[model samples]
Target chain A: MLVHAGNSRGAMRGERLCPAEVKRGLLDGNPWQADPSLANLSGVADALAGNGPAHRIIIDATASGEVADYHAHWLEQGIHVVTACKLGSGTTLERWRAINDAVARGNARYGDSATVGAGLPLLRNIRDLQAGGDTIHSIAGVLSGSLAWLFNHYDGQQPFSQLVLQAKDAGYTEPDPREDLSGDDVRRKILILARAAGVPLASDEVAVDSLLELAADGASADAGLEALDAPMAERFEAASAAGAQLGFIARLQDGRARVGLERLDATHPLAGGAGTDNRVAIWSDRYCDQPLVIQGPGAGAGVTAAGLLDDALRIARSTPD
Target chain B: MLVHAGNSRGAMRGERLCPAEVKRGLLDGNPWQADPSLANLSGVADALAGNGPAHRIIIDATASGEVADYHAHWLEQGIHVVTACKLGSGTTLERWRAINDAVARGNARYGDSATVGAGLPLLRNIRDLQAGGDTIHSIAGVLSGSLAWLFNHYDGQQPFSQLVLQAKDAGYTEPDPREDLSGDDVRRKILILARAAGVPLASDEVAVDSLLELAADGASADAGLEALDAPMAERFEAASAAGAQLGFIARLQDGRARVGLERLDATHPLAGGAGTDNRVAIWSDRYCDQPLVIQGPGAGAGVTAAGLLDDALRIARSTPD
Candidate 1:
């Protein structure tokens, strides 16, 4: 079933959307009931209270960090959550702790496998390795799909601005391209990885070096591009001349995290990727010398949805019949 | 508590080996009890039958294929099985089906993640991706740590025989080094990977190319090396002249599986590992163009034990308290 609390255009407010109605809104495939009155969290909870326990709950929306507290509340109520929401787990360490604590107390699961790398097996691998008594030393990667797309296409042949515009058109960038350019998304992803690797890192601890130097408040895609082109062009030129490629690299090492544009040699592990692929290299005691690498499509509606569904299946299969 | 069914040397034919005894057998880290009466499957089963349901049972022994039926029996008795034994899952398709059927019938989990790649997360990733609706295309890798060591060190500078001897001395190769050279281990692993990718592949379906031309049966490390040097030398010369390196490559693609020595370019994903590191590249619909890469130490007592313990922990944590 599709239950929407709100929409970008503010159209879903106070409406309990059924699976069929949601499908119709998304180009009609299956018919589902529409509950116009089941709009917000409390309404959804009330609706759920009328039914047996859910197999699992899937959250796949933008900036889902706003519902971080609600996620904790749900976990405390013994409900499993499978989310693609970075905000909830990628927020401050304090909130991350609360959510984890609630999960433990309620014996419920919080599946954020889709939060980073579009449901890549990175987090689960880290957790498993740790449980096996391996200590993680560091993690580094090209985490942002939009940024990866931008860098992979931003050769000296094309103006960086053109590549940014193309990425936005390809649905690889955020609505405001500056969000991709600013490097905040990459920071959030790194934070998520660090936490999964057993690091209690806060969002503010990451030293982010955003591409856009101008004020980012209320900027549109074109406006963000205009502000970012000059600086990015310079970086591309310098990197190209030095026989290197530009990669928006995020690193979590020695209890410190940072994200920025870095020039990586052609032979560098993270230097290879076309389009919107997210590549990550994890370094732990067992994998310390040569990091275990995971690379794949980091973003896209289909892949993200698949990741969320994967988490749901894991929970369902684990739960007793 | 350690339960001993049998020992290769007939030393523990009917003994219950405690943790301290096992440690002492490994050069005395701690002392353990040695009960010689628990010598066979029926005895172990009888002991287990007297107890309540176990959360999990771990099988960490050589030639564990002999116990494939026993593992299925345990799983049918409501016991989860975590195995370092590839034989249970890598056996003939008929036996494989029976074990899987038992797992489903008993609603018991089978932790075969430790069987291949030393619990490198390869199998689980493939399973999860398939469940997530992604179609896997192919999986290729250098899966054997002993062979990987031999190849990485077998530059034309050193005779291949000497490298094999060194590997055996370093505890990298099987006691019967012919077992490592016969390509049987790699074939079994490829079969496991293909099955994990949802292919109902039979063991005989794979067209395996063994490294040794002469008979390897009952051959010691020295004897196998003597028989292997000529063919291996020819390969090294041809590959070296072509600026390529030799690796024992296992590939599952296009509904066919093969394992043998292959000449890989310098930049091949599996060619970068050093020492006993095993590297794998997985291709799928979502990651079709750029295969997901995973590299790490594929063999070692510490890492393998860690993998087994990791599987045990997974089954334990998933079981209700």
Candidate 2:
């Protein structure tokens, strides 16, 4: 049964909630009735406080830092937090430590599988390897689905600007395509992976060579789009001449992270994925010679929802009644 | 702390056990000290019985069906079983059901990640998808490391038999190369995966087209090794002509499992792996247009050991103190 549902705007009891009502409200551009008794974060937390034998879980699906602030508090209250938000562990190293510390202090689980690779087992594998006493040497990946699609289809024959617009139209990118082109999403993912692999990499430590810099200002508004065409065409031609593909790569090694566009050989692990696939190669003490690779649809609403549900199920199974 | 150690021959207390002694004994071709009190299954069970607050775990590293028979009993007695053995869940439907029943009855976990894809996350992903309420439409993969290695190197110029021998020498295949060529290992893996996806498929239901049949008798003995040359060369040529690569693929679809050699296009999800990598494509309701793919080193002692340790750590963490 639904205990409570809330968003940044307000909170409410979920006793009489139904998916149809929620969907209708979302379609009508209005959602969630404000209940004063449960309107604040503390009220919601109090409603979700775990005092019974049954496990209590709070799912964080927002990108709000305000909601992320409640993660440690809720976890410390013995409430499990399954989050899709990157703000928890992908922000400052201090916040990452706080979430983990809260888990230890309250014996609660923090399921952040949906934070990276859309729950493709990347984080789980890294954590499992570390738990098994394997030292992670490096991790490299094509972490951004929008960038993957962009590079996969950018053959230099078509203008790169046209391709970006096409990708945006196809729902492969955000409405503000600059958000994807900025490479910050990839930076967050790499940070999450690095921290998971025992490296406390701060957000600013990752040197990002964003694709957005290639486009002139007002590129998203259909003007100045041609600025990206010549440079991108040149890079594609150079990569083709060397029998390589251009990929937006995120790398973490020696406790450092970098995200940028790179020319990778066809045989490279990160260069083998198709369409919007997020392919990652993990190098560790055990898997030293050939890195362990995982690839799949990196971003989608259905898969993300499935991932959150998977995390919840895992917590439910692990928690003792 | 080490509680007990055992093998097919006998078992002993782990109080004074050390890796050095085990290594020396193995080098000397004499492994265990055969204590009579812990010699048999029941004696070993009694020694490992969960009497205290501490969690009890049994690690099964053997390929013995005899040892697999005790999984239910040990689990029913509140002892966790972390196994690399395929005989437990990859066997008959009845045995698989019995193990699950015992897990539910005693609230014990059966860690079988090492059973398929060595230490890769194939089984875990399939399980997580199912747990998240996603319907698995199909799962296809190059599940055998030995076969993957063989096909990856088997140009029409090289004799398939020579490739098999090379794989054996490289430790990619079992000492008896026929075991790898027979396709039975892939069959067992497909069965395990199918069952994990909620398909209660029997062992006999999988139709395996063994590569061993291509070789005339005595192929492993060098006397008739060249007998496989013509057929394999012809098949390889046909696949090349069709712009496809030959892969020993295991597939589970429509509640059925099949293991055989199939010609896959360059763009096929399972066709992109390198050097003994186990590449798998999982098709489900959520991942319909494009399957979720996972690739990694499919077989290695270190990875298998790591998988077992990972499982043990999971159980230890999950168990309430």
Q: How accurate is candidate 1 locally (lDDT)?
A: 0.75
Error of 2 at B312 (Å): 2.5
Which residue pairs of candidate 2 clash? none
Q: Where does model 2 exceed 4 Å of error?
A: A3-14, A30-56, A76-79, A215-224, B3-14, B30-42, B49-53, B216-224
User: What is the docking quality class of candidate 2?
Assistant: medium
lDDT of 2 at A8: 56
Residue B29, model 1, lDDT? 23
The whole-model C-alpha lDDT of candidate 2 against the native structure comes to 0.84
**Recovered share of real interface contacts in candidate 2:** 0.66
lDDT measured at residue B71 in model 1 versus the true structure, 0 to 100: 80
Q: Assess candidate 1 and give its TM-score to the true structure.
A: 0.82
